[model samples]
Target: MTESKDVNAGSTASKERVAQFNQRFDFGSYAETRQFLDELAELSKRDDYYPDVSFGKTYANISIDGEGQAALREMNSTFIADMQALVTKTKN
Candidate 1:
């Protein structure tokens, strides 16, 4: 299995800790929410990055573990931006 990109590959002692970034997205309906999730899954597959996600009928809460190396942080930020863009496209 492929290792998670969010993890620091260096030794444990030298690992850098960062804060988590959380966001909640409200979708129009359950169908829209699922569609967003599907898009997220595709994005994750493409980027090899996946965040913690919780969802209800019309909402999804995303918690990205931003704690890691600098490259990981950048990846997380980009992932968040892409997710936001996906939501915007879904709403339009």
Candidate 2:
């Protein structure tokens, strides 16, 4: 699949969009996951980026692309990278 760039998120907003998302969003062990949330918030603020944040008691999701399913078609790589980093860290 062709990767999208310069779509909605620049090169910076990916984490902001992702970080703000996972903050209030639930993920099971809320206490242990504090570091992850802090990392996301720091990355987002540092990069000066913010995405559509959806918060719920049980779950939440973030969108770095434009909006809806179509925007996701053109996902910025930075978002994926950041997410991967988080995943890798958790996995280890």
Error of 2 at 59 (Å): 4.3
C-alpha lDDT of all candidate models, in order: 0.75, 0.49
Model 1: per-residue lDDT, tens digit, 1-92? 12345444564324425545678999999999999999999988887877788999999998765342255566654766788999999988
> How many clashes does each candidate structure show, in the order listed?
0, 1
How do the residues 41-82 of candidate 2 rate in per-residue lDDT, one tens digit apiece?
665665556555554443445555433223333443265357
Model 1, poorest ten-residue lDDT window? 1-10
Write out the backbone clash pairs for model 2. 17-51
Q: Highest TM-score: which candidate?
A: 1
Tell me each candidate's TM-score: 0.72, 0.44
Each prediction's Cα RMSD?
6.3, 10.7
Report the C-alpha displacement of residue 67, candidate 1, in angstroms: 2.8
